[model samples]
Structures are given as structure tokens and as C-alpha cells.
Target: MKELERIIHDDSNGLDYILVGEVYLPLLAVPNETREIGFYGSLHRNYLKDYKSGLYSYLSLSGKLWSYLADVNEQCVERRDYLMDQMMEQEGITEELKSRDQMEWVRRANNVRSRVDEIILNEMVYV
Candidate 1:
């Protein structure tokens, strides 16, 4: 979270990077306006997902944002595959479809994709 804040606030990156990262979704249903929502939940996911989602949602802003999002997505894919591979090796599971753990991974991955897509699509733009 601190890293994200730093990246968003850092003046060295110029307005585009700072603006994209600084934008966030607020919790509309909450009684207190101060409550905020983000691309990722702090209680569960690491900051990478939040960071990636931020970049993804802001793709319309500039080509630079799109490229950054792509890079983040690529890194996420590699990380996901590496985690699955490590799990399979440790469990000695050769068959992806047959392994319950692998299937769980697939299910979770799909759910996350859908969720992030929804989050991005429903993002609020402030003037």
C-alpha cells in the first residue's frame, strides 16, 4: 500500500502516471463517505492486483497506461503459472484437469478475471 501511494504521489513520473494511480473508487453503499474501494481488497490480495487493476481501468487515458497495464498483466500471468507449477511439483500431480487443486486454481483465476473486469468497467471518473 505504501509503495502504491508513493508511486501515485511521486512527482518524477509526471501527471499521467500520478493521475491514473491516484484515481480510486469509493464505497458508495457505506454511510461514511470516507470509506473507499480499490481494484484489490487490502485484506486479501497483495498490492500487485490493485496496481494492475488501476492501470487497466485507466487504459483510456493514454497509450502509456495501456502499455503499463499490459506489462502488469504479463507479469501476473507468469506469476500465476509459476505458482501452479510449484504446487503441481510439490503435490506430484502431473494431470492438470485431474488435480482438484489445479481446478481450484482455474476457478479462482476465472473469478478474479471477471471481478476485475467488473471493477474496471464500473469505475468512477472524477473531474
Candidate 2:
């Protein structure tokens, strides 16, 4: 327990236990008989369960959700790259399709790149 306290207090490995402790501290301060105590206690217990094991794992729900979004965005970019490669290969072999529709394929590929840029800027930069 002392080691946990030391790690939490020192923000070791960028763990922000101060944030988690701040939420739970007030519950510990209030009398147990109070009506709200049980509710707050349950919430604190949930926090403990969620955060007790791993270092730097106590991020709020929004942070976790954003992390998930970033992961999905990465996968989307990878798939887009693979599909664009296939399209480019097809364009090289097909003269009619290359003449009439290559620019459209370029536009779609640009759109995918733009979406990946937007995701990196908006969703991944902060996370």
C-alpha cells in the first residue's frame, strides 16, 4: 500500500492518481450514515476496481473513448491504403478505366487521406 501511495503521489509513469483520489477523497470524508454516502462509496469502489491494477490506467471515460477512436482511425487508414494500392494496380492494367475514371479514383483516395488527416488532427492529437 505504501508503494502504491508513493507511485500515485509521485505521478510515476505519468499516472495521475491525484485525479482519482480527488473524486474518492470526499466520499471518505463524509459520514457513512449520510444518504449520499452509499452512492458515493459505490462509485469510489468502481474507481478502485478499474484503476487498482495497472499504472496510468485511470483515465476518465472520455479519454478511453478517444483512445478507442484513435485505434479505429489507424485501422481505417491502413485499409484505405491497401484499397488504394489495389485501385492503382488496376488503373495501370486497364486503359479505358484509367482514361475515364482514374481522376475519380484519385479524388476518392485524396478524400481518404483527408479523413485520415482530420482524424489525426482532431481525435488523435490530444490522445
Candidate 3:
């Protein structure tokens, strides 16, 4: 388990019981690029069905959050891919390379990042 998971699991505070599931659900979902994030506790067979039920509950309760997170993850992947391409281009390999592809990817990545960043930052500031 990750250090964060360990900390959450070992926490004795009341807050742990309240927020542990919430925190880990998003963390697991984000890293795995999965919209279904409530299955972390289903590693054991006993909890498998319960895990699915929890997943359904989470999705029903916060489908928008999952969609937003997935979109953000997609944008991040696009940005990383574009940056990798830019690095490759800068290394002077151009004969078979397509500048249009490079430009489009970079622009898409930047646009996604800018929009998402604006939304997130504004929400943070106002909240």
C-alpha cells in the first residue's frame, strides 16, 4: 500500500472514518485513469459485491466529478504526449516528421490545460 493509504488506514481520528473512503476513491480513480474509483476495498472476495455496490453508489452520487476528473486526466496525457513530441522535434529529426501533427497536439494540450486550470483555480479562489 502507498504511504497515504497506510496513513489513512492507521489514522485513529474520527475524521479518518469519515473521509478515508472519500479521499482514497478519488486518488485511486485519478491514478488509474478510471471513472470507477470505489473498488479499492474489494481486493478480497468477501467484499467484491459490496465494492461493486459502492462503486455504483459513488457513480450515482458524483458522476460529474468522475467525468471532470477523467477529462483532466485526458488533458494531462495529451499535454505530456505533446511535450514529448516537442522534445523529439527539437532534437532535429524532421525528414519524416509532420509539423502539423506537432502543432495540433500542442495546441490541444495547451487549450485543455488552460481551460481546466482556469476552472480549478477560480473554484479554489472563490471557495
Worst 10 residues of 1 by lDDT: 26-35
lDDT of each: 0.42, 0.43, 0.43
**Pairwise TM-score winner, candidates 1 and 3:** 1
> How much does candidate 2 score in TM-score?
0.30
Which 10 successive residues of model 3 have the least lDDT summed?
37-46
Name the regions of candidate 2 deviating beyond 4 angstroms. 1-62, 93-127
Q: Can you give the TM-score per candidate against the true fold?
A: 0.31, 0.30, 0.27
- The candidate with the higher lDDT, 1 or 2, is 2
The C-alpha stretches of model 1 lying farther than 4 A from their native spots are: 1-62, 96-127
Clashing pairs in 3: none
Q: What is residue 92's positional error in candidate 2, in angstroms?
A: 2.1
lDDT of 3 at 77: 49
Cα-based lDDT at residue 13, candidate 2:
39
Candidate 1 lDDT by residue in tens digits, 1-127: 4445332333564442222456633222212223223332221123334555664444434334434434444544455556556655665555554475777656655555555444433342210
How much is 89 displaced in model 3, in angstroms?
1.5
Give residue 83's error in model 1 in angstroms: 1.0
